[model samples]
Target: MHSSVIATQCTGAVISQRERQTDRDKEIVLQIRGHHIAKLDPLGISSADLDDKDPPELLYSHYAFEEADMDRIFKLPSTTFIGGKEKSLSLREILHRLENAYCRHIGVEFMFINSLEQCNWIRQKLESPGITELTNDEKRLILARLTRATGFEAFLARKWSSEKRFGLEGCEILIPAMKQVIDKSTELGVESIVMGMPHRGRLNVLANVCRKPLEQIFTQFAALESADDGSGDVKYHLGTYIERLNRVTNKNIRLAVVANPSHLEAVDPVVQGKTRAEQFYRGDGEGKKVMSIILHGDAAFAGQGIVYETFHLSDLPDYTTHGTIHIVANNQIGFTTDPRHSRSSPYCTAQPLFTTFTRTRLIHVYTPPSHALTVLSLACYHQSRQPHAISFSESLTLGHPVALIVLDEVCSHM
Candidate 1:
């Protein structure tokens, strides 16, 4: 009789334990359902039973809720009931109120809880407004230029091309511009012209403008040693020296582009220094001869503080070079990002900074395949002997001419 009673009690206890577990499971399911419904409704609802001790995994499993769904529940208000009875609310309620306040302040319709904190901070500090309204003309111009240069396509090609490949569109513009500079320098009786630019179309400029032997370039590509001292540089990065007799001016000129490192705009000061030294060596009187021209990327020029530093040195007593002409290849995008994101200012090239020069001028030219304006701009820059900048916006068609000149001196002293 004692054994029978003990067995019966044991069975009853097991049954009661199972029943309690089943009830607990049902309660967890109900809580998750309530959380889901509350999340869907923006009016905000809370449950008092929601405690830190509740097993998140069990509640989520009972309701078949995904991880994301559970996250949403945790973000909801924590009041047990949907009434305004409690003066101070739980963590969820506080968070919901904060979110509502932020959304109202920023005028945003919805808030993403995951990024809410960051968004609020940005809204308050950066004063980030909604999207900008672009004009029809602006849209058309942007599309036209992007299509012409095909900057994206060029970038893709460069990535897969030869190891040290040159950029395409800018190269096309630069080669002719360089040729014009050489031609003009020759015409002006400049015995030597030295140029510097970052790696854009260095290879193209090398092959076409500098007239570097294609065979040497090919050998360099093959990684084969040649009897040339320029094996250290990419075909485009290599410098060249050219001597020519100008048919029009009946003068001889020597031209050389300085080899530069990958540091963009860092070469500006170096070029100026080299030109001044060359002028002094030639024993030329002030502003009579020797000139320096620098080509810059639009995004790099504006985004890099170094460009401003280099520009500030342009008018300095010791660093001046008649004047350094700045040419900006405005691709409207830098690397993979757009201009608006890269620069705070309207223009990517800061031409206005040099306004102190009486002869300083800023010209924006559309690029076309013929590059007539680019050629013309170079001629003007060489003739004027003044500081100038030309910006080539992307709206210009591919193969378009884009160039600017800064002529700070009449002629090279040598």
Candidate 2:
């Protein structure tokens, strides 16, 4: 066996191997393509495709796509063809069409019409239009549908209270809190975010935070009777992904809400590990360009030992990921179990546990009507790269339970 053949088989290159040749057999040295193929394997050739004199088992390994390749794929223009002669339209005209289509689709005739009118007046310097093409009956139908889809009053009466057993007030508090995290992540330079929360007001958050199409939600609700295994999770467990342009950074950001199982805080560590790996691959060391935000149920955050295990891993050498922003969706009761029975902690689930770790701050937020605390908490977390816990405590009527916690722990050693 020639040394050149063995080198070529191992390294896919041609190089010299002096040890294989006998001291007396110098004249019989192997030569390939004008180079001394003593030990050196030929460069730029596969092992399997080597000349018949030195063929091997495996061939060329397929090259994988690099980051730049993925970016090119995503930015490729859509193949869907739009028919019509392309003509420039003013921003006002484009906005008018957009407003009309949005309102018409959502059945929010009055609000969209009012907004459109205001926009038209400002841009075109024209007075608001009088009653237009849509008749009173048609307007009523649109308004009724919009109310059914979005209005808090209708949401509470027919959907939230009836379907999920959550009050209108709770939905109001939860929706804004979810949205606040999404909006704040976008405001920062975070390219993508994933949220995990149990089934509470998952439907409301989907509609409001992720901006899922209302028609899709309605269709799911309508088909519940006929479909046994529909492509829908319970309103709270369903997940959504949205991409938006961050106004501050003038760059695009992706937001994802992970579908969580009923195992409660099980998803917390999974989300953290994933986000940290993603950030590292993207060259975001020590939370410079990426973030992981987790939403938790109050009882699960307190009672689940996984929550403590996850918190402990935040500062560990192998799994420390700068830290994740943890939000506790504290709804007071875990199904039927009250807070007293759920845990022995005084403050809520995440706050007391986080206090065990140094340099971790737990902020108790009392704002239910205003989502300012949630938004501010996220802002501070991203800016400081610290693990912070923002707990939202419910009102007296809501039993004064903790509503939400925002945890932002930074990797110290990194």
Best by lDDT: 1
For residue 400, model 2's alpha carbon misses the true position, in angstroms, by 12
Worst 10 residues of 2 by lDDT: 379-388
Every model's TM-score: 0.48, 0.48
lDDT of each: 0.44, 0.42
Q: How close is candidate 2 to the true structure, as a TM-score?
A: 0.48
Put down candidate 1 lDDT per residue, 222-337, tens digits, no spaces: 77874456547655466666665654457776656777776767777778788888888888645346666677776677777776776666656776666556666554445544
Residue 201, model 2: Cα distance from true site in angstroms = 1.9
| CA lDDT, candidate 1, residue 210 | 56
The number of clashing residue pairs in each candidate reads 18, 29
Q: What shift in Å separates residue 173 of candidate 1 from its native position after superposition? A: 3.1
User: Which stretches of candidate 2 lie above 4 Å from their native place?
Assistant: 1-153, 159-162, 165-168, 224-232, 246-251, 350-352, 368-414
